[model samples]
Target: MIRALVLALCGLATAATAQDTAEAALRAVQQLEAASISLQEAGSGRDRISALTETVQAYEAGMAAMRDGLRRAAIRERTLTRDLNTQSDEVAQLLGVLQRMGQAPTPLLLLHPSGPTGTARSGMMLADVTPGLQAKVDVLRAQLEEVAILRQLQGDALATLEQGLAGAQEARTALSEAVSDRTDLPRRFSDDPVKTALLLASTETLAAFASSLAEIEAETGAPPAPDATALKGQLALPVDGTVLRGFGDADAAGIERPGIVIATAPRALVTAPAAATIRYSGPLLDYGNVLILEPAQDVLWVLAGLAQVFGEIGQVLPEGAPVGLMGGDLSDAQAILTESRQGAASTRPESLYLEVRDGQGAVDPATWFAYD
Candidate 1:
């Protein structure tokens, strides 16, 4: 009986081993399915990035149009001012008559009329005068007599128009700068030119690493990723922060420089602002810490300065994900770039620098962001 019990226990162990093998196989199949899904997501991201680019271009164009409109509007504003002034004088004279009627029955001007002709003027002519004349005048005259109001209305409208035009122009100016800087951003901000060269060299080395797990799905006839055609070039605020500074030279925290600027909280989370992946992340001399991202196959996204680099080369990320934290360690140039990159802020800043390059030449960031 003891011998038989031992044999029975050995048989049960064999059965358990078979069950574990089956479970492993099942889990692997599930992971393969998940990888296919990830591939599809990647395709969607690529399309989204494309759309984002187009949207940015459109926004820039819109801002350019607004700048022109404001110029014309500014001229028209003068006309409104002059008209308002003439109307105001008429209203003031009318109010004087009403004020006199308060103390006593004011004589009607026509009834008490003393003309050069010396014609007798009756009280019926006066009937057209006095406080009772409110029916004929008050509201219209109040509206008319208000030269200040008319001038103010023109002033207010002009102020609003100017504010919008300024923002639009600012965005346009920054994007234009970026276009010019596209070819040399790395070398411009590198610790040394050699380091910038090394960064570019490393980028090519990553091409061999693109063997995404989508290959298995390709073999299995699963669908490819969806293309997001609608999202291209959509203009959106890169961050939700207040405008710290804007394009042009301005001083803050005792720093000085050229280019558009932005001031954000140090250590605040930075994001791609569009779907993208790590193109380059490492030390660039003046950038302190740097990340180069590719939002589209043809376009690059650059962010410099960080407390830590959280992503690897070729890893994908969503728009506005935490690219890095501000370590209170950006070069003045990088700060300027940040402000310039967000050119729609109030008050031009000289402390920070910003630039953008579209293809070969400079375009305005304000126009890009504002157009859409």
Candidate 2:
């Protein structure tokens, strides 16, 4: 009888713990739903992109929490089932004792001479079982409460998950609309096939690249483009991120390159800051993939360190146009290189390197872009 009562109590505690886990998981899902709503209502383009990236990460985490909660609940249910099975005979004995005690009149239950020691022994035995019986009743009551709580949590989680799915769909639509809004614009200069070929074949350094493109524009009588200078202090950053390394910061090699490195969420969106012509878009040196944009007749914007580049050379892009995505993982070629060097893979946050150059030299991008 004692063992059955103990097992019943253990089952109730296990079930209650499962309910607690489910409640925590439900809270996580609710938080993710709220984040999605925030992304939808975000005022700035940069904020919207940043929130969208975070929302994706939150969704992944929430799903994992929900799965873990369900798994724990299943384990608890199995444990309760096993405990009940093991205590089946004891439970039967307990039930029989209860039935007899209830059927007998109160005086007979306490004073009847029905044991080896007659009345004294009968009373002692009843006293021994009474505490265990009350404990069993308490366990039953707690189990009922646990079941009711678990049912409520399960219902709430289900509704939240459904709402989360709808919010995710809405987020995707917003992203699509944002991207489509910047696809078309006036070109800074028409691409000359001969000059384009020469520019790609001859440039070895960024300085040389800028000079060569400038010379080609002069020869082609490139029409005066819209002044990007007016956008200084007003232009939004191409990607949603924080600047990790600023202009003129020296690297390990002591080379002070003219660019800013931005740390962003994995696979974050990289957009055009202003309408420009795509001068070059492909792999370039240690920067991985890159995009060169000529927003004005003399100035060229260098955007690099991308996982993938979109569009093609000579493709004109409006302000806020989607250019590419930051890389998440290494490519097969990069992985092989790391293996050969016996070096661990990099786990750095996705980064974008930006440089603005013109007839004079590299200038502070902070002077132009709206960074905060």
**Candidate 2 residue lDDT tens string, 1-372:** 112212222333345474554454455555556666777788875556546545544443443344344344444444555566787787788888889878989876656555546888767877897898989867755655555654444433444444434444454446545544534444445656686667767768877877776665432444445467788778888886678888999877887889998886555667788878787778765677889888876788899998867666766665666677777742232232233223222234788999988775888888778786
Q: State the lDDT of candidate 1 residue by residue for 1-372, as single tens digits.
A: 112212222222232223333333334334334433443454443443333233233332322222222223333334445565676776677667566656554354333346633334455445565445666476565434443343333233333334433433343344333333333112111133464465445543222112111111211332222222234446453432334444344555655332234444333334556656455567654545657655543344345445555455445555544454444432232332233223333222112123333333333445434322
For all candidates, what are the clash counts?
Answer: 47, 0
Q: How far out, in Å, is residue 310 in model 1?
A: 7.7
Q: After superposition, how far is residue 16 of candidate 2 from its true place, in Å?
A: 23
Q: Identify the leading candidate in terms of lDDT.
A: 2
| Model 1 residue 335 lDDT score | 32
Task: State candidate 1's TM-score.
Answer: 0.32
Model 1, total clashes? 47
Per-residue lDDT value at 291 in model 2: 91
Provide the TM-score for each candidate, comma-separated: 0.32, 0.48
